[model samples]
Target: MKKRKVSVLGSTGSIGRQTLDVLSAFKEDFEVVGLAAGSNVQLLIEQIKEHKPRFVSVKDTELAQELKSTLSDHSIEIFCNDVGLEFISSSACDIVVNGLVGSMGLKPTISALSHGKRVAFANKETLVVAGGLIKNLLKRNKGEIIPLDSEHVAIHQCISGARESEIKRIILTASGGPFRTWKEQDIQKATKEEALKHPTWVMGPKITIDSATLMNKGLEIIEAMVLFELPVGKIDVFIHPQSIVHSAVEFVDGNIIAQLGATDMRLPVQYSLFYPQRRELPFNLFCDLLSVGKLEFEAPDFNKFPCLKLAYHAAKEGKSYPIVLNAANEIAVDMFLKEEIKFGDIPKIISSTMENHKPSEPSSLDEITELDARIRREVSERAKTSKI
Candidate 1:
């Protein structure tokens, strides 16, 4: 068995830590060739000592140099910023797992695909912002992009044995976050702590807030459309409070297939990293099926979750609209976290920013970046005078 060499971007994040957990369990089966993180130098140093990867990268140039001094005993190379991401892309590895959040995930993904390496993608923003470009790149390079997201993974598994033509709809499940049942009046009072208490999954702060707004599901809807080549109309969202069933696919033959397991990120991560083969792990067992009660589903009231509606509009409009939407959302979330804005103002800021932008069809990567900066600036300006 040839061991799989892995390069993990965002090595200090939730997905990155979970990826390490899987690698630890299957030590002989996988090798950590490179690791990258934002600014958690302490944790990165600890991970460096444990896995002893050949290369490491941090966001800050000075910090990266300092960390290199600390890891002097280990003969590992260090890099910072885009150069570091490029190193991971061109490294001698069989798989590049992109756990980096936000638009930063895009270039690394393109870099990996260009190098003909398999990508285990947890970064939904990449697909949301540049789905067509990445799909074309994958086709041209003859490489594969796999999903590490649980909902997408479940949909992949459910439709694996069936013909694509038989698919009727893809049903995506959302845990509805901590504010699912809160009244519109009460939602404005939701603090960062209240919003971060996700009912089912443990994720990063940006994504956790996205869940609260149901915008995560909205982004996943765009991701599903890109992954399966299905129309946005054919992709549906269901608010499943249990979250035990990851996702489902209903076929034209009246067969509805679903994937069920403990709400663990590792299962999907492992599945994508080792596709067409299943590895043995201490699996979570199902118990008391009847006592668990019934799984419930409800249509998402867009009136309550306007961010979701914004996502769908951005996705359908195409061009730079999604980029504007994502960039604005990132800025709004950052401001909300800093208490520079209110919880209710998050959507207002994003919406106002989107409304002011004039969408242009970005024909290349440079254009995308240009548009992203413009929207970020515009969004920041709008956030200052936001009435919400």
Candidate 2:
């Protein structure tokens, strides 16, 4: 078998690290051709040493300089900043695993697709903010997309051969985060520590906070629209505390098919890398349904998690509001992590940002990024005076 060439953006993050782990196990099946990371030069150096990718992208000039100084006998080419990431994305590869976080991930996906390479998309921000743009790109581009997130992967698996028109709705299962059972009043005062204790699925800090607020599931809702081209109304989010059923798709015929698995991200990661082909993984990695015993499902309470309601509104409002939603949420999550805001303030801040935003279609990537920056700045200013 010819080794599939792979490039990993955001090589230092949670998804990137897990992807490397999966790749290491299947060395005979794939080749790590390029790597990129944001400001984690030390970790990037270590990954470069192990994977020995032909190209590596560092966050900035200083980090790039540091990585160069750390280089030991590796004949690898290093690139820096955003353009460097674009270079890595467009480089020769079979698949580009865009594990990058935030709006920055969008460009790399576009770059990879323009170069006719398939994308294993894990970044929800890319779709949430630029779903329409991505749809236009796909119509003209040669590349294909395979979702890396568990929920989308589950839906993708269930809808593998099913016609799009036959689908009634797609149901996304949420673990309900760490605050699932916490009282509404208690949730307001929840600490970062309490929020990070995800009942299932280990993820990065931003996403974990989002999960805690149910905003991550909300973001996934918009992302589903981009990936599946389904209307927001046709999408449903169900609170599934077990985390076993990742997601489900209901057909017009009233048949509901779901993909159930353990809370392991590697399952989706491997699925993205090797789609339509299931690789052999250890039996222990498989889900134990008997041990799980029972799975429970409930409708998400918008009153408890207003961020979710905001996400749905943003998706429906559609123009630049989704951009505002993402930017505001990112800032809010950062503020929460920094102890500058209370748990409840996450949605409040996002709401304020969205309410103030004048929706406009982004004409270009620069506009998209500028809109994100503008919203972040406005949100940061609002957070200082926000009564959280």
lDDT winner among the candidates? Answer: 2
Q: What is the TM-score of each candidate against the true structure?
A: 0.96, 0.97
Worst 10-residue lDDT window for candidate 2 reads 379-388
lDDT of 2 by residue, 138-252 (tens): 8996698999999999999998777679999999999898888878899989999999999887888888999999999889999998898888999999999999999999999
Which regions of candidate 2 are displaced past 4 Å?
A: 385-388
Model 1 regions more than 4 Å off: 161-164, 283-291, 385-388
Alpha-carbon lDDT, every model: 0.87, 0.90
